[model samples]
Target chain A: MVNYIKLIQNENMKIYRRVGTWIMLSFIVLIPILVSLVVLLAGGDDDTTSWPLIMLESYFLFSLIIIFTVVVSSDTVAGEFSRGTIKLLLIRPWSRSAILLSKYIATMMFALFFTIVAFIVTMLINLALFGSTSDSNDLGGIVSTGIVGWGDVLQYYLYQFVTLIIIVTFGFMMSSAFRSSGLAIGLSIGFLFAGNIITGLFAMADKVWVKYVLFMHLDLTSYMDGGTGPIPSHPMTLGFSLGVLAAYFAIFNLISWTVFRKRDITA
Target chain B: MSQAPIVRLQDVTKVIGKRTIIDRVSFEVRPGEVFGFLGPNGSGKTTTIRMMVGLMGLTSGDIHIGGHSIRTDFPKAIVQVGAIVENPEMYKFLTGYQNLLHYARMNSSITKERIQEAIELVGLQDRIHDKVKKYSLGMRQRLGVAQAIMHRPKLLVLDEPTNGLDPAGIRELRDYLRLLARDEGTAVVVSSHMLSEMELMCDRVAILQKGQIIDVRSIRGESGVGSKPTLEEVQFDVDHPDAALGILEGQGSGRISDGLLTLSSDRAGIAAINRRLVEAGINIYGIRVKTKSLEDQFLEMTGSETIG
Candidate 1:
């Protein structure tokens, strides 16, 4: 188990040591600040509460997070092959599954780290620019952000991160299954956006199977507003959406582990 | 040399896409020796090394390292082995120390002292903190050796380790490998296409040809002093080549060519033939013993196929 953590540490060093990764992270911080600056300088309303404003910015920020995390997750395994370093990594005492697991854990940890950075940065900037929510002694006192409580904002980020985890994991699976990093990145990102379009098309069909589509469950924020899902015609609950996404997360990881452990390391 | 084998391959084979890339190859590498896998291009040297290190799965048969089977007990078996398969490609963004640290972390037992010792062993202490991207190919190869030996594994496998090195770097690596085997009791498996380099470096060489080992023989006399060698080609530079050839005729495998008499004989045979030539009034000025290089035997065995 100690060796496993060290392997993850090695992977993190590889990921964080690169200038490109820091660029991705800096954009994660910079985009939120830029968005908040635009809102402040553009002269919005006086009663702009940070929770709702930050919530809106969170949507944009999470997209950038998805793109960043997808870039990292897709490159984690495939980059080793392209760089010809997989032989160095796999020849160690750990099994192939252990190496693959460590890479997965590291990428997922990177996604979580990016999310936390986005959360802290956006929350602090919006609250400072618009109003200080930290001064509020009561959780329910932020009435200016109408209808939704501050707790719902936290829930919104949590649900958004959960969705990001699923997408990043899908990207990771593509990484392990393909030898080329470019193809893995292209396919996973395409699947991330194309999933919604396909889900929308599936939503129009007069069939019950549309509710179980993986893309339909991605937007868990619909559940935060006490709504069924994107397709309100279907009776999809938060529990059902979570169940579907959970199944996919497992399947993606299964394919990744199976394909990775069986690979010949020909590169 | 009687030390128990550190790694043993028993009919280890690999078949890719219906083509036998390695055909039932078998050999044992003992501790405190430099074992060479000599072959030309497309001879399955890399494939066989890959199988021994478990980078590629075996189609049939098994490999044992430190009494553990690599086929079944891989994680346990691999702990005894440290290898750089084909190339020493590291994370270019990581510094040399970071690169060694990266590999050191893989096996939890390697300490900071071990890392420093490896850095010093490769003589990279001055530039150990520099990023690998700035390193020369020789420096990277040195850093590669540092990482491979970080764990002090019982078996060290290097495939074509001298590929991009200059002559000086090659000699440095050769000395370090020999030192590691002698002082640390490590079994070193090195594969290469350069027959002359192998002859200079290896204590024993297994000539591989077309996915099979044709011969495994000891490198005689070069191991140390007092080690006797078999019949070798000896050339005599004399005043009268014809008279010398006639004197040695039917007594030794002697023939006149290139204005000199070349004979196949051992030290004792050379001494006896020299006495006969001198008795016959043939002035034998110089009796130079020719080391039978593997190149001659390799070319004869493989029909002079090109080698690196």
Candidate 2:
């Protein structure tokens, strides 16, 4: 267990010591603050809804997180192969699975760190610009009829985090399967947007298998709104979406581990 | 008590796609010995090293390090090994010290003191805190050696370690590797296309050609010097080369060129031929013994395949 932790630390050091990582982290905090400033400058602050309004406005910031997560995770494995550093890492005492697990865990930790930073910065800006109040209906259509509070805000972040986890894991799987970081990042982001469109198209087909598609369950936040997602007639409950996401998480991890462990590292 | 060989390769083979890259190459690296892997380009020296270090899977056979099979028990076997395949690539974003520290964390036995010692051993103490991107190629190579030896592994494997080093750097690396084998009793295995460098550094060398080991020669001639009478080319500069060749005809292999009669003879055979030539009224101007260098021997052994 201690050795595993040391592996994680080593991977984390490799990630955090890069200037690009720091720049990405700074953008995570900076972009949210900039969006809040733009909204305030547009004379949109006097209407003062609630804290959840800032969280809703910060939903776009999650896209930046997605970009950050995809870039970091894509570079984690593929960059090692491209730079030939995988040879050094592979000859160590640890198994390939252990080394890959450390990289995956470190990438997840980076995603979580960006999520937390986005949450805190968004919350602080919202409180400073528009005072926090107990107005239950101020969630601005994000939660249609729920009595939203800090608990709902926390739940919103949780759902977003879960969705981000799926995307990050998908990126990591691509990174492991491909040797080119550009290919991995391009394919991952392309899949992220195209997957939703494909899922929407599948929803119109009236087939039961549409529910099993990966992107159909990516937006766990849709369940928070208490409405049918993608397929209007077929409603997906929170438990069902969680279950679907869990299955994908498992499949992505399985592919990543198998490919990474069996890779020849010839370069 | 007899100690087991530090590294043993038993008929190790690797087949990629439909082609065999390495074919049943086997050798052992005893403790405190510098073993050299000599081969032409595409001759599978790197492939063999890759299999031994577990970078590439072997199609057949097994490699044992410290008595642990690399195929059956990888982690246990790899723990006793340190290797740099082709080039010692590192995270250029991290400082040299940070890179060592990162690698150090992977093994529980590697301590902070050892990391410091490795830095000192590589003579990187002055620039240990600098990022690897700022380091020169030779410095990076030294740092590579430092990381590989930080764990004090029993078997240290290097592939083409002298690729980019200058003369001074190469000499330094040669000295350091010899010191590692001598002081730490570590069995060092290195592969290179530089026959002269291998001749100066390695104690024993294995020559590979077309995915097979054709010969394993001792650089010190320990096996060929005292135990057996090995053939050497002796050139006799004589007053009449044709007459001298006539006098020494059929005794051994002889060829005359430019007033010099060259004979392939052992020490005793050379003495007998010298006496015979003088008695036959052939005045010898000078007799020069042309000891074949490693390059000549390597070309002669590998069918004179050009090394890239």
Candidate 3:
């Protein structure tokens, strides 16, 4: 018991102070602002241009979450290694596993926070421009999707938190494996972008196993529609994707800790 | 000898890449003793210190700090030992106080007052509020020293602590270390190639050569009673430094350098050397008594050919 939460707090404070983190957060805010302006200026647009869709599609959606998670996690350990701070951190009384876990937890927290902030800003802008209520039902049958409810938003976010944790854990593993933050970030982003292309290619070829990969089901919105059961129209069950994601998380953490424990802090 | 030892190493050896960096070296640091370790470059000084602090594992050895084995009881041993290998690695973005506080939180027992005391001891009070990235090199070095003693460790290990320091800073560090040994009973192990600094700072010294302890002696006792010419007068010069080995003939140990001979001999025999060299018509331009600084002793013991 190394007071892991305090360690997380310590790491979070370090991240919060950095100019790069602030710039990334600012960019997260900028996206929905820009999207809302475009939607409002083109008034009388289709129902798809509503606030919830803007938030879901442009902010808390898979694309933005992937960007946020990749930035935070890839730089977590890689930046410390480059700055020569890992040696100081490692020589402390804590174990290797505890330190990595702290950074992982902090990255997850940042991802969730960024999502929430983006959601709020999009809601306010949507209300100001379209004179719409923040209720899910008013956001164009988003609540009537028949698979989720207003109260379940927190639970869905929680699951998304877990998914983000899995993704960021792998990012941290790559960070530990690579010395350059650019390479770690690039690899993470590339995987997120390329996984869909690979899945589509495999689906076109009738390869059934692509659905079970962790990359295929990172979208919590899809899970809300089916709830771990196989969607009638989709290829893989939600349970299978969740299982694969859990395995990836475990393997990533194991590899990260093992490498960090043995790494020479020559930098 | 009345008190327990603070740190001890037994048969420590570190091998890297088919080359033995540190041989089977053993020494005990008793409580309240300032033990100076003198050696030339590549003499395995940093390697030995790293093993002592458990920063690196020994190839074949056991290290005990404050009565705990470094391997089996690493937390207990490492908690009682504080070290700065070369330059202390710091979070440049964090203020000095914040950095120490972060390190302090890792150790549950270190108090705020103790951290303050460490900062004050290093004379960094005015700059402790500034970010470390903005601090001068000397200030950073002092902050490094502050961190090392923040926990009041039983043994404080510093490798070349005075490097890059002005003469005044060096003197300040030396005085602070002496105060630590005298007042707080903290064991200090310092490694440096600067012989004159060691001669003034250390009570006893261990001369290391090629990872082996060539000689271990007390500064007071080695010079003999009532100061026999300060260990400087017993030294003499010869014209044919290499050929003087035959002339010395079991009288003393010496080496040749650039057509000049520098040797340490007993008092009466040194007087005999002046007569022999002149009678042999060996042009000895430098016949005055030469002193053995810590550097001279280290080079001679290690038998290294290069000297600055």
Candidate 4:
């Protein structure tokens, strides 16, 4: 267990050391700035605009997380196997399952970090540009520019962040299954590209279960605003999406460990 | 060598697709011994090493590392074994120290002092802080070795560890590995195409050919005696000398050639022939022992004409 933790710590450090982390985070921060500029130029009413909308806009770039997460997690095993470093690690005392799980958890942790930072940056910008006009204290209190209450904004970020976790995990699953990093990235991006199309097609087929698919429920912002399809309309059932995602996460990791543990390190 | 076999493989077979990459190979390395795995490229040397450490699954048979079965107790078995498959692969973006730290962290028992000690052991202390991408091939190999032994594993498996090294670097690595085996009792398994290098470093060797081991025996003093020629003298460029063929044919021991008949005879016959060739006015420009090389043995076993 201790070895697994150390392995995860090491895996996380690889991301922090790479230039990609800052590059991705910087792009994330830029999204809100751009959205605020557009809104300010158009002279939109502050009362109707919600910070959560900016987060929803960040979803377009959410595929970036998918792409990056796939690259990071796929390489965690396949890269080592190709480079011949798997020999070094596997000959160690640690179990194969532990090693692979550590890598998976580390990638998820990084995704969470990226999501939180983007959420905080967007929330701050939203408050800086727009003042609170809603009545309830939950929506009325503000730190600066009289924006929405910290509690409300925090809840909003949590909702988006949870959705991001599902996306990150799905990316991890794809990356773990594929050998080539580019293939992993492409397949993950391809899913995001084809997801709405597939979901729409499936939805139109009139299957009641289409709403329960994890991919269909990824857009939490739209779902949170009384928009309903797959995700439960009530905010209280937000844990359901998280639960389905956890099941996917469990299966993905289980397969990765089983395959990778017994995988021939041919390279 | 100690009584305990530090690493052992029992009838291990690794098959990829329809091809058997390593077929039913078995061997053992005792503590404080340098076991060389000599073979041509694609002859299953690397595959067998991969199986030894459980980096790959065995289609058949089993391997035990310091008494733990790789199939059933892989974690315990693997803990005592340190291996480098092809090139010693490192995270190019990380410094050598950081690379070691990462590997060290995975093991938990490997302390910072142990990482430093391993770095020093590989003679890379001065350059240990530089990023691995900036390292030379020799440095990378050394770093790979450093990572392997950081936890002081009982068995160290190195595959073609001297591939890109210069003569001096090869010598340095050889000495370090020998010292590690002697002083620390680490059993080392090294596979290489360089017959002379293996002869210089290993105590015993398993010569593999075409996914099968041709021979596994003690190499010490075995090459220079018993009319077994040196690997270096196996090749000879001869001018047309039909008379030399008559002399060899008369001797009744070897194939007659255009000029050179590679004779596998007793020590007395070899010495007598050398004297007879000189006395018979043959243009004996060169005469030397022709010990079978790892490549020659591989070709003979696999019946391959093209050398890998």
Per-structure clash totals for the candidates:
0, 0, 0, 5
Report, to 2 decimal places, the DockQ of model 1: 0.67
Alpha-carbon lDDT, every model: 0.86, 0.86, 0.74, 0.72
Name every residue pair that clashes in candidate 4: A132-A146, A211-A230, B229-B290, B229-B291, B230-B291
**lDDT for each residue of candidate 4 in B17-94, tens digit (9 for 90 to 100):** 898888888888899999998877788888888788777788998898878898999888887878788788888888
Error of 2 at B48 (Å): 1.0
**Model 2 regions lying over 4 Å from their true place:** A48-53, A134-148, B222-231, B234-288, B304-308
lDDT of 3: 0.74
Listed in order, each prediction's TM-score against the native is 0.88, 0.90, 0.81, 0.83
lDDT (tens digit, per residue) of candidate 2 on A188-207: 89988997798778878887
User: Highest DockQ: which candidate?
Assistant: 2
Would you give me the overall lDDT of model 2? Answer: 0.86
B94-194: candidate 2 lDDT, tens digit per residue: 99999999889888999899999999989999999999999999999999999999999999999999999999999999998999899989999999999
lDDT of 2 at B195: 97
Report per-prediction Cα RMSD to one decimal.
4.6, 3.5, 5.4, 5.1
Point to the candidate with the largest TM-score.
2
Q: Write the per-residue lDDT of candidate 3 for residues A1-267, one digit (tens) a residue.
A: 555666877788777867778887787777767766775676644443344544354424546776767887877889887876665566566666678878877887888788787656765665566554334334444434432233445555566666667767778888999967888888887876776576555555545665666666665555665454323335566567778778887888889888876664556
Off by over 4 Å in 4: A37-67, A134-152, A209-212, A225-227, A230-247, B17-19, B223-302, B305-308
Better of 3 and 4 by DockQ: 4
Decoy 4 TM-score against native:
0.83
Tens digits of per-residue lDDT for model 1, A1-267: 766788899889889999999998888889889977887787753655566667666777899889888888777889899999999988888889888888888988998898899889988898789774433322234333332455877888899989899988888888889978898889877987898898789888989888878888888887866787878778778888899999999999899889998888889
